[model samples]
Target chain A: MTEEQTRENGDAPRGKEKSEQILDAVKERRNRQRESAAAEEKTVNLVVFILDGDFYGFYGEEIKEILPYEPVTFVPGCPDDLLGIINVRGDIESVVNLHRMMGISPGEPTRDTRIVIASAEGIRSGILVDGVEDVLDVPQSEIKRPLATLDRSIREFAVGGETLYNEKYVTILDVGKIFSKIVH
Target chain B: MQTQTLFLLLFTLKGIRFGVDMEGICGMEPLSRTSEREIPIGWFHEVLSLEISRSDYQSPMVLYLQNAKSHFGVIIESPEEVNRQIDLENIRPLPKLMEQLCRISPVWGAALTSGKGEKGIVLLTDLFRWRDLSLKIESKTATVAPPAVS
Candidate 1:
């Protein structure tokens, strides 16, 4: 059949359509890149961890390292929040139980317990979490500011919130504000 | 020497002696049983339920302490007592000692050598530094629940 006749009849051969599909694919890829770049600008990297089945994360840059849970020496007269001192590479680092800090029931640590080493205002400390989850690229648009009526203590520690694809909630902690009142 | 006077309210926890400033402490009372939900973070040991008579309504006030800014219930073994005041001016700063103690406990300002030649005074607010540490330990370490006391 002649090209014009086929075009007018709308019965173009399959080979002619291949080029159009390729063009559409390139356009989709460019749109995806633009979307990703915009997302990257708004969100910060967060290392997410689990505590009592709830998801929580901290700014990835704020975390120094993640270590295995080690035995700590309990000190008398220490605050109930103070888990004890752990010897991390010969330096004693105070460890806080994230579950206890969140007012959750204390659960025995298994192999999953991980110590997240973080520094706030030059005060180096370790936080014990139930387990270390994958690091997420949380976008700023997903974060929701905490409501004013939230508990005073809880509000002080929270920086913002992030929503997961499955519609689950994750709290982004403000490590600096948590330790701002503490004297180093 | 001109001395800065600091009034301390002394208390005990797990048989260890520590003191907080009188100004930091609102009040103290005998430790009582508290509901599990009412206790705040970092204060697992100090949670207590107490009754108060204010105006025509009698309600319960949950007395909490700040450990590194984390609120925990205060379980007072004995009624809080106002211990003697120390002169801050007379006290010498123990930078080395304070740094060492900070690793283990929350000690901020210290008062060295009272006029009568006693141990130096250590500020109690520094104890809050370990609030996260203590809670972390409690969660990981297996603990036997204390027997119910009548």
Candidate 2:
């Protein structure tokens, strides 16, 4: 309405000469929308680790803990991938060798080796790995499907797809499927 | 709350220690002292499908386990007297995954032991399950026996 009223209301004095101010208003609106969209993009925490020189990960919710690898009591009569069972604090958890399960001949464990305790749907067990790399939140949309060329054993349980992080490709593991296959 | 003390007879087969309920344990005696024909004999290694050798059971002794009316003997290493009375609370149930993986082994549960010269997880086995395994072994041996007789 009046020039004084426009100034008091913080409204742009309307006219062709106000083009710069109009552009600023558009920019501010765009930034607000961008921030809200970013806030809406779902993210999930992932526990990524190294296996046979490849990066693999599990959803953070499925991973209970990671402990320094220790000697596991060799359980007889189990498949080779089933390394054995271990004493975690007071609980008895069976450990599976991911390298052997994927048909890779594993070497001796190094100092960085870890036992990842995974619990899904009340079923729990330990997964032996060469080492753990990182635990971070990854945008769910960034995860892609497991490479079609992956071995059948990996494809059998691989899920959540793969994500590129820190210059490495981290394939998400389907922990529930892993437990189901191991159980059934 | 009442605490139950689980009595187990401890032994090792190929250095892999295992335990069995002492309740069903009839006795332990030298293989030479018993009538071998009176009770069927099954080697612990053979029952467990572990690598078996003639010398694997060096100084082997017979551990008798009884069920209901019938009793049987299994060849095992000499009992390692590492505390037969285990706290029932200490026996940990096998992880559900292991329960499915340990189909052939008679392992019902396990106990994590420490100090007093006992360390690591001791596989608590069920001898009666081994007796079940023994029947399968006997049937296999019998199936092969007729060809030898003929």
Candidate 3:
């Protein structure tokens, strides 16, 4: 029987079968392209730091440099988060206590404390951290949103969270939002 | 004040320990030394006002070692001592228990946790930020007069 006559007799049609095979091939190619794009987008580097005995990280690209802690000049009538101004490389930067920013008690600076220099919205500021951990390669799929119970300020500052191989939670900071308010 | 480690005079209130940075605190004087009549209106009613001598010859301010909002003043029954040169490494974050107590007042001192945990240092400066923000909001609301009735 001819192909049209076979379809009328309730048999598999030749033309319909060929079109289905072509459609399947297009879908398979599209899926392969999408998978590779997703994989490429997930790769990024981050520098992690400890604050309030908890681990937090920010994208490495956002950080300018990490420096040793120096005495901060106290300015009267400044905001509580502002620990005063510090002279870093002849440029004055506002030093902020991350503990205070996190709405936690401020810890006195120890030998472990490090000042992390970062630029947000073109305005450079320094954040005092309890200690510097290490730089890590964190993939995008590993990051998730913060729990609802986390502090509201933390939620605002963090873009997402990641769980390390050891299963500890690491929060990824959003530098743009952090600096946007300060720059204005 | 130039020292790396800050000293704080630790005290107890409502069964919780609270601390203030030694720099922010002038000297802690006897409660009997200051007269209650000189105390401010919003000062903690339960605390016996103590004279706090500060820089810049202004009037000596009264110190109240109690939660001002709740008016629960804690009496320093025993002699209070100062904790000196507490290293930052030694001070740990506030435990879940102490954090709850801190919300009641901004004047909490140092909290001692059990099981070899480090003492939690409380900063009156940090604690007052929340109160200051609330007061600003309140003042703004009060200053803006409501629409007058027709």
Q: Write the residue-wise lDDT of candidate 2 on A39-133 in tens digits.
A: 87789899999988889899999999999989888777776667888998889998987776677778798999999999897888899999999
DockQ of each: 0.03, 0.61, 0.02
Compare the candidates by DockQ and give the number of the best one: 2
> What are the clashing pairs of model 2?
A144-A161, A144-A162
Per-residue error (Å), model 1, residue A118: 0.6
Task: List residue ranges in candidate 3 displaced over 4 A.
Answer: A1-41, A181-184, B1-150
Q: Is candidate 2 or candidate 3 better by TM-score?
A: 2
| Ten residues in sequence with the least summed lDDT for candidate 2 chain A | A12-21
Predicted complex 1: DockQ: 0.03
Model 2, B5-35: lDDT tens digits are 8777788776678988887887787665655
- Looking at candidate 2, what is the lDDT of residue A174? 83
Report the C-alpha displacement of residue B114, candidate 1, in angstroms.
39
| Model 1: fnat (fraction of native contacts) | 0.02
Pick by lDDT: 1 or 3, better one: 1
Cα lDDT tens digits for candidate 1, A39-93 = 6678778888887887777888889999998765444444466665555553556
Q: How do all models score by TM-score?
A: 0.45, 0.81, 0.45
Q: In model 1, what lDDT does residue A127 have?
A: 81
Model 1 Cα shift for residue A129 (angstroms): 1.1
iRMSD values, candidates in order: 9.9, 1.5, 16.1
Q: Model 2 misses residue B25 by how many Å? A: 1.8
lDDT of candidates 1 onward, in order: 0.56, 0.78, 0.55
State which candidate has the highest lDDT: 2
